[model samples]
Target: MNLEISIIVPDRIFLRDNAHTIILPTLTGQMGVLTNHIPLLTGLDTGLILVRKSVSSDWIGVVVTGGFALVNDNKITILVNEAELGSEINAEEAEMAFLAAKSALENASDEKRKIEINSQFKKARARLVCFNSIV
Candidate 1:
């Protein structure tokens, strides 16, 4: 059985296709979805969304930041604030961004500022991870 998955960002749709399985990084933890899986709705974490179109197909990695996921029947929809395919990320830029975020995090004094910096750090890290996995 094939499951349909769609990933939407603010400006564009990252992916829309049929897949054999999907692994989502939720706020609570990772969740795996497949055809015939029970319905679900959950908040996403800042990380990767892995999709497999077939048993023999390679996984497609998408880096996302803050999203919501809904699953009903065999269809899955992900609405994220930001989304980028693995191939779209530049490793060098991601590394530089990661370093910047790290420095900002270290310099943040207030709790709120620290939280914001941490979020940026997470996003940069996710981008680097996706880029590395593609290589």
Candidate 2:
């Protein structure tokens, strides 16, 4: 049997899985973890998570950002800061958010402001990517 997994952010359930592989958008980079994989914990990046179901070759994608994931007991639990899906994302809203973040980044005068704006900018861009993906 494949592992069971779930991914959630504060506002939504990103995914629930019985999968052969769970490709996480880790801060270090995209990493594919499979059943009986080593126990690990890592920070997630703002990028696509591609889940491969046990009997299928095709991968399903989700967007995850700013979180840590744990793998153990044939399960992977991801507690994300945020997550979004292609079908649920609104392009207009994402663009508007991107523009606002850009403006803030441009006008930011302090380190904290820069950091805040940058985080928003990345989140917006990741949403755009998820919404625009073909698969």
* Best-performing candidate as measured by lDDT: 1
Model 2 RMSD to the real structure? 2.6
Scored against the true structure, residue 16 in model 2 reaches a CA lDDT of 83
Residue range with the least summed lDDT across 10 consecutive positions in model 2: 126-135
lDDT for predicted candidate 1 compared with the true structure: 0.91
Per-residue lDDT tens digits for candidate 2, residues 84-115, read 66667788997788788889899999999898
CA lDDT, every model vs. true structure: 0.91, 0.79
* Lowest summed lDDT window (length 10), candidate 1: 126-135
Give candidate 2 misplaced runs (Cα > 4 Å).
10-14, 54-58
Error of 2 at 88 (Å): 0.7
Model 1: per-residue lDDT, tens digit, 20-134? 9999999998899989999989999999888899999888889999989999989999999988898888888999998999899999999999998898998998888888876
> Which portions of model 1 show Cα errors greater than 4 Å?
none
Which whole-number lDDT from 0 to 100 does residue 39 have in model 2?
89
